[model samples]
Target: MTKDVEMAARNGSNGAVAGEAYYPPPPAQGGDVDVDDDGKQRRTGTVWTASAHIITAVIGSGVLSLAWATAQLGWVVGPVTLMLFAAITYYTSGLLADCYRTGDAHTGKRNYTYMDAVASYLSRPQVWACGVFQYVNLVGTAIGYTITASISAAAINKANCFHKNGRAADCGVYDSMYMAVFGVVQIFFSQVPNFHDLWWLSILAAVMSFTYASIAVGLSLAQTISGPTGKATLTGTEVGVDVDSAQKIWLAFQALGDIAFAYSYSMILIEIQDTVRSPPAENKTMKKATLVGVSTTTAFYMLCGCLGYAAFGNGAKGNILTGFGFYEPYWLIDFANVCIVVHLVGAYQVFCQPIFAAVEGFAAATWPNAGFITREHRVAAGKRLGFNLNLFRLTWRTAFVIVSTLLAILMPFFNDILGFLGAIGFWPLTVYFPVEMYIRQRGIPRYTTRWVALQTLSFLCFLVSLAAAVASIEGVTESLKNYVPFKTKS
Candidate 1:
């Protein structure tokens, strides 16, 4: 499969729920030709390429909040939590990879997407639930991206203001305005010709993610080595000194959600698996790739989160780059923030375009004869530089952008939002679905020790998600008391 397949499956996930079983179209008979059994070009992906894809998909702007999360959980719980989440993701990923082939791990019909696997193994209700999770997660991600990008943009402006004026000068930049500007930009990009086909956008976003993550790690390392670090404890922030007991509990819960968010890539694991060749079987290769990617990612996260905590223990900003953690090296900070804005611009489309396509596809299917919905008018600025514009496409995409931006404005609590998104996704997408699928596929009987273990694990994660959601909501409520819409500051 091409990278377009990966990007489509990355966010809005293939398409809507058709409420039917997924059966792969029969391959052409006597397929000993150049094409694979499925009649597509033979995949050339190796364990290394698969590993690279997994790493890129997992690490993103989400890593920026690790230090703050670490501070909430303190030294002991923080790293342990990161490692634990990594292990869980890795194990569940192997289970998911096994589900890629319906019957056998090596040679059953390919279930190309997560929904494909769920539809093949699970029930109709599961298919619908999976669709809801994928779509809701994609839309929430769009809104989260908007909020994150605007904060980075406002950080640049605020950094400039601080540099120009005295240290005490008010350098508050309105986050909601930046968010609105970003929404307007996305509205324009939404109409690009075959926007999903611009696979380079995904590459660019990955590069930007690495650049900022590297900058964050470097800055935090420098801060730690330079000495005079803040107070840090094995138990983390003090209950009475840094926060009240209730606030401590809330922060810990939110911290769990934040760490969960940092590892949010299981939704696309099957797509990544689909890219691999099958001499060694895609499942085996994907299992290796998951080990490499998750292990490497965990090490990187430890460096970023641990060093940032060492630099500003109990005071790490929710976002390392935009959170005013470092004032000097203003140029580097500005560049990092610029990279963030650029990355998110593409990453937004990486996710939201699938959503746009899914909705537009459903509309066309529903109203086949409606010209406004089904017809694409080829509008040209020049002979060769134009795209087919449809009224439904333009209006629906714009409305989506507007609504997401408005939601971001209403609740501009960055950490709280990230935590909430993570909590909502962690249980169902990462744990429940994969575990359930593994059991059904393997025909594990009920009340078996293995079955009980899986269910127990799922229940534990559900409790964590529940607690995280409550904490994030509480955090948002607390934030609302201080800031109104259009008034969030850098």
Candidate 2:
């Protein structure tokens, strides 16, 4: 049985590569071996399930901010930039997928996570670098989601307060208090035993994503047609060309960063791909799933961004939902806020799983007998009842949630943080590693036209990411000047 497990891991179900030259780390610990009680393999998800997972991960609070992003760039640049990023991401996603298998389909080995792929195709130094950025991106994303969810909760509470009173009410439920409540909810769902167990949640979250996005677009279009309640003005014209060129450039670059962040799902591509059923046609399955997910998300982005800018114009808040104000259709506004909170819960988990996997894998690798790999708990009717929870797992996972919750409470600059994370992460996770690994995997010669073009793209992404990072820092600093921590404004 043990030998069979080893053989199965070595000869991945996916037939992309053909040699046993590249072997993954031990599976008994945490290297992507799904075995039953009797030690046989277990097949899990389909292409649609995978697509749902990708969609759930990709589309989150990012979509909510697109209207503002559009407002920053105006209609012409907004939609075009988004479409361009979509194309770039799709192309890079294909590159990442191709790196999943190491041998031929019949006997090829598979990379279970992003770091795994990096270690296999790239150098150890690259692996360490990738691991740091990937985990940072995931943890940072989880923190962002926590903040967004709390904001949604706060918005809902604020709306109810306004309904009870004649004006906006100080509900005493600031972002921190809401985050505390949200932390408890995340703690429960975060304990779901495995990635496979969360697919249903992902599907529901995908549905929720489409639901709120459609509502947002519908509301914006209606508002636009009826004439905007707030003063409406075009982007470039509102600021005027007479304004400081430096300030105009700063805003433009910041918008570029936001758009980049909106498409920042490359960090978790391998982790999502890892969930597919073995004999996994990773290349084909993931490609198809990426197309479906990206296409769906792109449609939503374009509609919400263009229509939202049209409705609110330069008056759009960082979150378009907030721009709806406590108006006549207050019920729909509340429902939309509720949906955002719900979707964020799922988004938090989709990213965190990779972090959990990476940490557990490291623990297992370091201490072979620590029981950190896979421990058996009680079993139910032919099924595993609960997770293989241990002191390390419980302690670290709980601490992670607590820390992220705290960060969300402390620094609630949603758009600024999103831009910062995207800027810092874009170069390494999105462009550099993927392109470099692809060159090595495909054995593309240096200085060739294809190589030069890809390299130039990577360099461009790096420069833009750096500029975005600086701009994000400035934005955060400026926001902090007005921020009164833990205080709820009436």
Candidate 3:
């Protein structure tokens, strides 16, 4: 049977003997392909859990900034650019799914992580490249979330402490203090044993995301309908379009980069897909999960971006929630900010898990017993935990949270940090790797039009990323011209 399976795999057909047909294959006899100590696999999720994970990872603080992005590009370019990103992301995500599987049923192999896939299809050097960008992007994303959560907490706190005359009664409670508080909370939640353990947290985070997004859209609609007449503008005409063509073009590219960043989840697709049950249909399941997740996210992005632009016109803040201030409808604003805080807590974990997994995997490979919890310790603890909370894991994860928190407190320009992350992360993780992997996996000819087009697209994405990096640096430099550390935003 094994020889036949190998032969069929070599022939590039489903693993069936000459006389036999490939019908529905039998269920995997093993409990799970990725089993734990008790001989049970942890792959116990369905499409819903997978969708929840994708949604939680994808629709983060990025959505909060889309209105400002829209304002930069105006309604026509903004919505169109967002939809374009959605399509491109969806297409490349399918390419990634194809790379996850190799060989035929009985003799097939699956990539357990993104780096695994990269190393398999590309080279070890490329794997290292992917890992570097992947970890940096994840860490940057977590820092962004820390800043967002701090902002939400500060808003909530200030709302509770405000007087009737629009003054913050407790002005001393700054964003940095709340950022520290958020970091402490994350240090606890970041200890979840594995990606599978975060399934429920992702679900709750998705719900929280939906709650705040709905509130944002509702608030925007209400303001547009009931507030001052002629305040909202659709075209750039009323908002006073950028007079200089060069400035207008730069803003357009910046918005493009922001949209690309908002749509990025390719970095963690394999990690999330690993939690799905093993079968012939795992790839299909993952594709469906991506479609469902992206569809839901794009809908919210469009509504929030369009409505937010309409409500604020050219005056939209980097964070749409900030537009509400600490005044009337303050309770709703507080509730929405609380939802954002809760959602980002889960988002921080979602992005950070891949980093933890990669570090632990590397440690295990480097030192055979590095990530292990000894039998003696397990017995003393009186529990059969699936993962080791060894000294390295405890120390590094804690330090990562601490460092990211400090960075957030030190540099609180949300949009600038996001632009920087998007610039550094978008090309390698989102565009270049996936397209190159797909072309290599399929043996596409180098000089063919398809190959050339994709390579061109990757180069274009790289240029956009570079421009965004420069713009972000300029923005940060302007903000920090005085170079004050740990300065809170007023």
Candidate 4:
């Protein structure tokens, strides 16, 4: 695996080299293997890594919350929305395949950082701006995960303690302490070497996947028993809210961020160019991977949407797992809490890795061989700016830890956090990045005159549908007021 990875990096036709190569580390001694505390040499991630990322990305809070996404358009549009999201994920993956091909053909360097790859080859400032947007989206994603995990932990402890002794409020303190402890642990581990140390992280991630699947299965079974004939029915009241048409349009437009997420994440293609065993010399492997990954993600989304709505019927909303009573017989709530925490921790690293690399690039450029600068630089500069350069690369690991912790503290509530997350972070990063990259790489005049005209009609349609999606999310708070099983009196 290591040899294959090295070969890909060496023979890259892409215009930019892997950033890791540009700042090469000292040569490793032959026959000397670095092993983690478990005495296992870090497996350079077999196919399992790819599978894990796909499942984790596909089955995040999105799947749990997708029922809410469908409610806006109506039950009829639910499957269709799943199809659309899947199609978009696949199409956007195609664009990334093209970028990877271009990099391989042009640079002789296969792997490039997201910004470096885009800026060096695509040659557009706005295209690089997409990287910035990706960072934002990732941070939002991390925050959502943290908040949800915290809520799950709280609810589980609350239910158990309340059941044992009729004082439920004590659960609140335990939940907060659990979240704080989790945050501190995240901060500590954020300093670990190589965010991509895949051994334990991969195992932990897979365990989480099983837990999520279990929760999904439990919900599916429960719904089946509750009322085999029960189905989600959308009434005019459910769909018709007070929001204006323009506002509705604006809201759906929010989903565009999903596109940006598709693009920036597509940069994982660069990693493929670096790793992956015996990837096709004709570069067909990348195309195949993209198709497989995106298709798989879409399928997962559809399943989640279908099962989630079916399970909750009219009650599904953001973090659908919460609607299931946070602590049921199958230990669903505790399982989800731990699993999501592990999943988000891994994702947070991936998201922050690029930022760290970029900052390191900046530091290197500014202070070439100045020993003092190198020594005191990370501390003086990083501490002052709230960046953690103590970690090997400050971008993904430490930065992600810091950002997730801070945001988790700030956005303590439920759907509010997810809604703000979808609107502010996910939409911009996912939607804008690819379009910006496409225009920048192709050139605005040509893109606008030729390509834009071709894609515009389709884009506008997506835009409108997405607008409806957003309106649906907006009306969710009111819908929640009516639908929640246990309502607090004013």
Candidate 1, residues 1-490: lDDT per residue as tens digits? 2232222223222345632111111222355435455654466677876665566556766788999999999999999999999989988888888898888666688876677789888998998898788678778888888999998998888888888896788888788899999999999988753332445565676677778888888988887888667788888889989999999999999999988888887776776676678789889899998998898778879988898898888877888775444267888999999988988887677667546655765565455456676555656786556556667778998999999999988878889988998899888989999999999998999999999999999999999999999999999889888886676777
* Candidate number of the best lDDT: 1
**lDDT per model vs. reference:** 0.78, 0.76, 0.75, 0.49
Q: How do the residues 316-424 of candidate 2 rate in per-residue lDDT, one tens digit apiece?
A: 7788898887655878888988888888888888988877756654554444344333333332444433333445556777888998898888888888888888888
Residue runs of model 4 more than 4 Å from their true location after superposition: 1-27, 30-48, 101-107, 121-123, 166-170, 173-176, 228-231, 234-264, 267-274, 277-283, 370-400, 413-454, 461-490
Per TM-score, the best of the predicted structures is: 2
Ranking by TM-score: 2, 3, 1, 4
lDDT tens readout by residue for model 3, 70-182 = 88777787898789778878888888877765544223566667777787678767877887888788888998899889988888877766744357355445688889999
Error of 2 at 453 (Å): 1.4
TM-scores for all predictions: 0.85, 0.88, 0.86, 0.71
Q: How many angstroms is residue 417 displaced in model 3 relative to the true structure, after the best TM-score fit?
A: 0.7
> 3 or 4, which is superior by lDDT?
3
- Which residue pairs clash within candidate 2? 13-279, 15-105, 17-103, 17-104, 18-103, 18-104
TM-score of 3: 0.86
Q: Per-residue error at 370 for model 3, in Å?
A: 4.7
In model 3, which runs have C-alpha deviations exceeding 4 angstroms? 1-42, 105-107, 163-172, 229-250, 370-389
Worst 10 residues of 1 by lDDT: 19-28
